[model samples]
Target chain A: MDKNMVTNARELTNTEFFYGHKACAGCGGSLAVRLALKVLGQNSFVSLPPNCMSAVGFLFPQISFVTNAIIAPFAANAAVLSGIEAGAKALGLKDHHVVGFAGDGGTADIGIQALSGAIDRGDRIIYICYDNEAYMNTGIQQSGLTPYGARTTTSPAGKNLPGSIKMKKNMFEIVAAHGISYAATASIGYPEDYLKKVSKAAQCESTSYIHVMAPCCTGWGFPGERTIEIAKEAVDCGLWFLAEYENEKFTLNRKPSSFSPVKEYLMKQGRFRHLGDDDISIIERHRDHKWEKMLKNWDS
Target chain B: MDRPKVVKYKEPERAEDYPVGATFKAGHLVQTNSGWRTFRPIIDQDKCIKCLRCFLVCPDGAIDKSGESLEIDYDFCKGCGVCAHECKVGAIRMVKEGADEDGR
Candidate 1:
């Protein structure tokens, strides 16, 4: 680890790389981008897709990013990062980092192919997916990363259905399958852990990807003040896990002895309020299955 | 490529006056966002532990920690109350926007 690693909040830079945007109050995605940019520093070349961060940060006549940044197309965030990396290298730029901030819809649904190609080509870029679980910028619509039983504008809860019937795509494992240089799963609730991952990604010589679970207060139907609390509860309840893949091995950073009740976490969010006991059981069963596989194969 | 000139925003009278590609300087505070806030966070300096948790968690970067005492930049704070909610010692309180003597 480098001496510049931010192990605590006080060590973080006072210089705000992201600020003065129109993001909703207590927006987790914006916070994630802000904190990651702090870790990456001012020399970072940031590429954001047409997600909440870009929509809110790149307002015309009032741009937010202090570092050099541009808005990439929704499906070309990774490709743009790759281009930035190659262009910087050609220009003989030193001590510069090429990073991308894409949302779940941009990463898992639209930008996944471009991301895969970048990793396959061994491009030296950092791709951070601030997964808010759905397409929050364009209203609350379900995406491929939306969890099962969560109510979205498109996937409503009613007598016949229990919201989204599909589970979130395993983005971390999928990225790791490419034998990328570095990959990690993070959450805004655990800022320190997420910061460490961002730092590690910046240090990678080749492509690196970090999938961070950022909770959205407006989309999730929760009080703005409760964003951090709800994000922590999600991980504590076993819905999200912190892990990293390096050197062709997976390591779990946190292994809770026992998980908190899933119902308490679900009932707090408006999206999951309509879920029944059967739906809750199904979610728990899936969580247990995932844990069983991870505990058996992954190193803790 | 050379760094683009930082042009101040102005009402465009003609198309030729606009900056190339409509580029704006990064991190330029275009306008104050205080109007968006319904509540304001007031920090009790005596009770604050200076943990810097609130500083790191602020989405708007409204909390200023560079001075001897932490200051809340009301111009940009949207008053989400996350800092007050995350305060371990209840040092930060969210007051309704117009309830105070300042009437703001």
Candidate 2:
């Protein structure tokens, strides 16, 4: 069982990420930052790259972080985090969590080399990718992590093709390949779970990675209000999977008794709205197969 | 839009007063812009059960829960109506940001 931040009775958490930062209305990435910081707290430091998070939240003088945060290049967050960890050790600093919070593009594509190198070098860092599916801050261009059949500015739907036919790069599994201490998939809708994951990851003897599914209102073409709603729907419909790899063991969390159909999740977003019944069914098939593979990995 | 206040850094003792960016824009960020929002959610205390549902689902962290009843900080709220939408009991409603009396 996971430890709860639950004090006494009410499920409230003191946060290190504050408002007044320039995140869009109902931004899931913003919430992810808040929850992650809620666990990591004032002792934590964030090394952000040139993603939406760095662009808006920490807009120079008008910053929003309640903890120490620094900006790194798109491909160098992991490298920077490695240095921070080394420096902390050299100075004999304890309980300081150096986090590399990047977007999907930064993690799965541009920054993969540094991330793999850091993992291989056994850096004690908490690396989190708050994935909103595409390069949102740069105007919604589809990246390697964008799911199949979702439309982006680069992968606009046309008569020939529905949208992006590329399957999202499996970042969670790939990070696990390096044989790190911990890695997991989490979503903004599941705040306590994400918070608990961060809390646990902070105590890891080695690198910890969390790939958070953050819904983008503007990019996904959903109402700003539905950011949390669609996030929950993503998990409820099995489009997004939550599980962890800790102590060299795979454990899945919160499986629905009956997954609401893939359509129930897809139809909510305009990007996936272009998807037809055929596309949804095909996606559903993939989802089921992915869940099966995850179960197999867990039982192994 | 007004820029954030930049605080001058002093020695170790005063350094604690200034955080990461050393900007004093903490709580004053909500309604600083002229064209920030078109709608805002108003809580109906009569129907509220204090479930903290609205408080939890607020993406911007705009809802203030310090008081006995839940209140919204107009400055931080972007009038997203997410709180209104997420209220399971329909205890919140989205009011037009400017249609009625000038929303402070």
Candidate 3:
């Protein structure tokens, strides 16, 4: 581990590696990309799929990444990252990192196969999934990572059915299960922790993954400025968590002594505005069940 | 394949003036996003603690902290108010765009 890791906002690089893109106001995905790029420095090669980051980043005649970056196919973000790593190695490049920033839909749903393949091959690359909980760029569609009670365009809240019945996929654990060199769950709300994870991923010799929960203001139905606040609340309320996997071990980071009210967290979002008490309880129950298993199996 | 060049933004007089491929220079500020902003964040230097919280939280990378005091680049800032919202010391305030300098 780097002794002088950047643990504070003051220690972050002053350079703006990501800028002038057309991301929506307070877009959490863009913040994740910007912060990660700052940590990776100018030598990094970024691969983004057809997610919000790419849509708003790679606009014609206005590329956002200062470093070498490309738009990979929807399901090929990790694959492109592997190729970039191989090319960099072939060219004898040093002090460079190949990284991919995919959205939740791209990671947990579409790009899982290629990501798994990259891990299986032990490719030296960093895969970051900035999960805003759905296919936010494509008009708020239901995705594999969408929470059970969140409403979306496809999963409409009606008189009978709750929004989405499927819980968010355990992407961090899924990647860790492949025996990855490093894997962590983060949130844009916790910038220091997220920055440290990116720095760690850059230092890893083999496949590394970080799944960051980024709140989508437009899609999630919250004030744009409240994105970071809501993201923090999610972790504090036990809906999202911060953890890391390494050396065949799982470590829980920042375990809350007692979770804040999950209803308060969910009610702030427009997508959950229609969620009834029963739905909230179901979500809370699921969270408690997951935490019980995590506390028993992981090191806190 | 040619080495990518830093092509500056210019109005194309003819179709031939366009770049050869679907490519652009990295990190080029091709366009300013000030038009999208409805409100702008003004930093109160007296109250600012230099915590760099606003700089780190600005999604657009519009906050400039290279100087002695933080500055917001109005050209690219979308006026989302995240900086003002995140500032813990009550150093930043969101003012309506096009308002008087005194925040009338």
Best by DockQ: 3
The chain B TM-scores of all candidates, as shown, are 0.82, 0.64, 0.81
- C-alpha DockQ of every model: 0.49, 0.28, 0.51
Q: After superposition, how far is residue A209 of candidate 2 from its true place, in Å?
A: 0.8
In the range A144-250, model 1's lDDT, one tens digit per residue, is 99999999999988999999999999989999999998999998888899999999998899999999989999999999998889889989999999999999999
- lDDT of each residue in A37-95, candidate 2, tens digit only: 76676688688889887787665445666677778888999999999889889999997
Error of 2 at A170 (Å): 1.3
CA lDDT of A182 in candidate 2? 95
Q: Per-residue lDDT tens digits of candidate 3, residues A1-300?
A: 576477778888778888888888989999999999988888889999999999987877788788888999999999999999999999999999899999999999999999999999999999999999999998999999999988999999898889998898888889999999999999999999999988888889999999999999999999999988999999999999999999999999989999999999998999999988999999999999999999999999
lDDT of 3: 0.90
Error of 1 at A151 (Å): 0.7
Worst 10 residues of 3 chain B by lDDT: B1-10
Q: What TM-score would each prediction reach against the true structure? A: 0.96, 0.88, 0.96
After superposition, which runs of candidate 3 have C-alpha atoms over 4 Å from their true positions? A1-4, B1-8, B12-16
